[model samples]
Target: MPQLSVIVYGPNTQGHLTELLDSLDAHPLADAEVIVAAVGDWARETAGSHSPETIVVPLPDGTGDAAARAAGAARASGRWLHFVHAKDGLPAGAPRLIVERTAELDAMDTPGALAGPGAPDAPGAPVDVLLFDHVSTTWQTTAAPSGDGRLLAAVGRAGLPLDRSASLLRTAPLLGNRALRAAFWRAHEEEFTTDDEPYAACAALLRAGRVACLNQVAHEKRVLRPESLPPLAPEDRLALIDRYESLLALTEDRRAARTVLYDLMVRDLVRTFARENLPDPVAREFFHRASLAAVRWRPEGHQRPAGLEGVRHSLLEEGAYTRYRAFQAANRTRRAARKALRSRKRQVSVKVRDHQYRRALSRPVDPHLAVFTAYWDRGVACNPAAIAAKLAELAPHIRRVWVVSKENAALLPPGTDHVIPGTRRYWETLAGAKYLTNNVNFPGAVVKRPDTIHLQTHHGTPLKRMGLDQMDHPAAAQGLDFAALLARIDRWDYSVSANSHSTRMWERAYPARYTSLDHGYPRNDVFYTATAADVRAARARLGIAPGRTAVLYAPTHRDYEAGFTPRLDLAALADRLGENTVLLVRAHYFYGGAASPLTGLRRSGRIIDVSSYDPVEELCLAADALVTDYSSIMFDYANLDRPIVVYADDWETYRTTRGVYFDLMAEHPGKVAHSQEELTEIFLTGAWRDESAAKARAAFRRRFCEYDDGRAAERVVRRVFLGEPEEALPPVLPPEERTPAPTPEEATA
Candidate 1:
């Protein structure tokens, strides 16, 4: 018999099924059977393409997920049964880890086992259940680690009686994160007849002989997109009351288990009541039904949880639905009043300085006035700068004023009109401008008028999670107020996207009603427009000697670290690459003003610090190759068709702390090196410019450089500044037809 039977089930049309199956193939188990419960013709067809050893069980049309799961379970023949949904996945090496842990349990002596009373405890007895950790991911959020870790950590690796670890009942709500012994499952098969997995999980926990916790994340649960989820019927929501009653009867004799189960039921009902938007009649009905269950299942001498929750329990026990509604309304009113008071205080604090700005806001917006900023007022650069320059030639009547910080004021062109942040001119310009463009968000204090057009020309293609997606990574979120962020995003009338991938990510992350202008990044237009002379001039400006190789080393910031910390020893790397090569090091903009740590190497003429360099387009034009780790610069550099290397020494750490949209190592532009030694070897061995590297770079360019052509800036200026239709704008040139700027070597040749 196989050690484990993995039963997978989902709707036939589920789009993520292929990803799930592919992950399983990449990380296969040695002694496990896979049973795919194909629910329709499409599912069967897709399953046929997978390994022939996988068992495909066809189900009739219109079958629900629960019935499919039951069918798969009935066909399962292994000693252990594990369930998986087609939209979910198994993490790498998780299957082997799970199988090994369960095998150990089977080999242990049965004496003194924590199996519950009446359990058969002969030698080689099977464990009732083995629980493991999981991650939950949604379209608008990154993967969030399960809270079950703390409870499971306390239970240790040893098997324990259900009563000894009754608190594990909190996690009994999820199904796919646990495995059950086939023998144990057969004994309690009748209890799982219901369609509700939570109810069945509760039943199994109440009756389990012995349970163990696997403290590793073995499953990846994909939360269906909000629009994809079907609304819960009134009957389905009400059925929870019946499930909880049945569970209460099962746990009647077990006091600790009964208390935990009761608390779980009440919490579940409260969450549904608070989160779901039901009609008034249905909501009242649900509240009435829930109040009765709360009163009936109240454990003796039970202490209600503290704060607003305890108050809610008291109201529920009284069966006062009207009073509960009133209480919720009053609380909302109090919160709104407090928020308004805070706003009023802020206004008072800035009233004197902002008086002229307030006056400007009341007046009609100036149709010819426009405002632009980039990198939080660093200087005029990026897509905003490109658009601003084009606007000057295309719509000369429109007055453009840039927002710059006092320190960066000198960096702007001598004749350029600009306003310093926090000054009266800055406030008036922001208030009066009918068109505003920025690469980053303006300060939260700035008011967005309805008549003003806001264009968000994001600086780069997203590799790391952004906007609402950062909610799960606390290090990345850094106490961000999502509500405020959304308010700012709401002001955007247009969001510029570089490619389809970026368009999808931005839509999901920001989730505003703004229209996406899929006209490639304007800043990257330089790649196609620059002449051979331009490339040589960029190289000369950066002090790259003729006939020498220049490698641009740009690394992204780490949210887990306090400040800039170089991951590579630049001196050692430059020495190894020989004096024929020069490194153009650019740190992330987050550490813009910090002193360079590579000053010694810069003095040696081996390293040039371009951390504060304007128009990174110039840096890309000067380099022969690009070396980066998780920086969006790779996406832009691919346009040049240069050899790109990913130096990811701390890839796992970065992926965990600051979640990424995709695995860069798997679909890299060129070669990937995990260590400094490997990186040096790649350059020395001429592998960086090999045929394999060219193929990777070609594929990467096709995907990312889809819309970038010489005319991107013209397209933006025509569509946005000139008020022309998208059809009238210039069409994008295909990659093969477009010519990127020549390298210094090609220019010199």
Candidate 2:
């Protein structure tokens, strides 16, 4: 038999199942079996595709999680059983750690070892349950270690019975953090028949002959937003009373266990009563049932907790539902008054603006209206612009308005309807529009309406760490308000991604409930749709000579730097490169209107500054080759099937401070240059366009340019704006089949 059997159970539509399985595969354990209790045909198929070696026990549709887990346990053929939910994942090396710990226990339980001075009564006196540490993650916050570490430390590596560690009951009530011996589980299997994991945990712990603690974090449990979770039925809420009663029976003889169990039961009920929005009848019935349980199961000489909780316990014993309601109402009134006072501290003009915005929000949403913004209202550009252009053709009935800054308003197309920020029309448009789309987040003050659908059309694939991932990299997260960032992310109804890599990274960085649309970036449609003549026109517009090779040098901004300091000496590099080549320098967008440091070289006719240029897509079309370092432009440029050279001089500092998702030096599209000399040598030696460079570029394109097929705009427009189903949306074309636009030289030839 295997050392351990891991059973994964959840619904068919669980989004993070693949991630969990991937984690297990990444950290393989010897002699460990994986069993997937797939609750539906779709889940079975997905599990099979992701992990064919996993033993799949297909449960019928609508089967409860409890039944599915029981089925998996019945099929397990190992010494120990560990359950994992599909949405949760194993930390790195967790499987090996667990298996090693179990092996140590097995050796201690061997026949010859039982006769030792401090040995147990029998050879089978091994630990019945092994509880470990876990981390809990919410949509807004980063993963934080859960459970009482001090309690686990007190138990130490040596085993202890549940009675000795009964205080652990107050720690997180989750089954994912514990492992049960298969034989011990079989003996008390009936106790877990119900769908209440916490009650099952309590029953198992109370009955276990021996329990141990492992202080390492083995599991990562995702805590869904309360509003995002489906509300439990009234019957399910009432069923908690039955589960607690059964748990009380198990703990009747042990005072320590009894006290912990009773306290836990009362705390669970109180939290449910205070937080959940139950019907009036169900609320009263729940309170009455909880009161009877609290009075009957109260341990002799058991003192209630201090302060507000103690008062709540007294009220529960008295069955004072009316008094509880009044108490809660008074507290809420005080909270509201304090909130009003805080609001009044703001500027009078700001308060007036907020009041007007709130009044506008009260109005009914306009179904036919949509608002669009990009790059913090610089103008309509990037994915938002592409989607808007497509909407004009396919969804003209849905009126579109662009949110632009005062300076950018003049850059918008002549007939484009637009509003400046901080204007009455802007607030009204944001409030009334049924569809709100942007590449960047809107103002934090914008309230998300129930009817409004916010689509986050991300501008580019992420290479550097984003969202909560930036928390550890203080340089990248300078003055970033994570709470406010998550609040904006919470407003998203859909997040668009360009490829599977991007989809996975986005999920890790932003753990929200938004649906992921793995459609190619709409902005990249021009890369595939532009013709030879269009390429030529773009080059001409950028003032590039017809036969000269144009190398576009675009570098990302450094968070550690206070200003937009140029990383490379543009004049020196431009002079080193032959007269046959010219450099098109584009600074990072953060320094858009700043004076170019290379203005002297611009007069020399070798360096062309395109920082203020509109529509970067045209710049991509105009360039023959791209040279970038740690910029997402390389990922987008790979779609053109052209040569790319990574000019990374401070790669070590950048990766350490910025926390890149992947090591660009190892997975670059083409040659990597650590210095200007190396960059110049690659061009002079013709290595930039050699066979090795082409092969590397092909591999990069296959990975990063999976969904750009000249029709991404149509796919997004159909799905979000037109409300077309996934089945009806346009399918993504393979990267190998795509043909990029011709270069200016090729077009002229």
What C-alpha lDDT, on a 0 to 100 scale, does residue 544 get in candidate 2?
A: 85
| Each candidate: RMSD | 14.5, 19.8
TM-score per model over all chains? 0.55, 0.54
| Residue clash pairs of candidate 2 | none
Q: Which stretches of candidate 1 lie over 4 Å from their true place?
A: 1-349
lDDT of 1 by residue, 366-402 (tens): 9999999999998889999999988998899999999
Q: Candidate 1: TM-score?
A: 0.55
Lowest summed lDDT over 10 consecutive residues: which window, candidate 2?
112-121
lDDT tens digits by residue: candidate 2, 584-698: 9888897665434433336345689887887888998898899999889998888888899999978999999999998888888989998766888999899998999999898
As a whole number from 0 to 100, the lDDT of residue 613 in candidate 2 is 83
Cα displacement (Å) at residue 703, model 2: 0.7
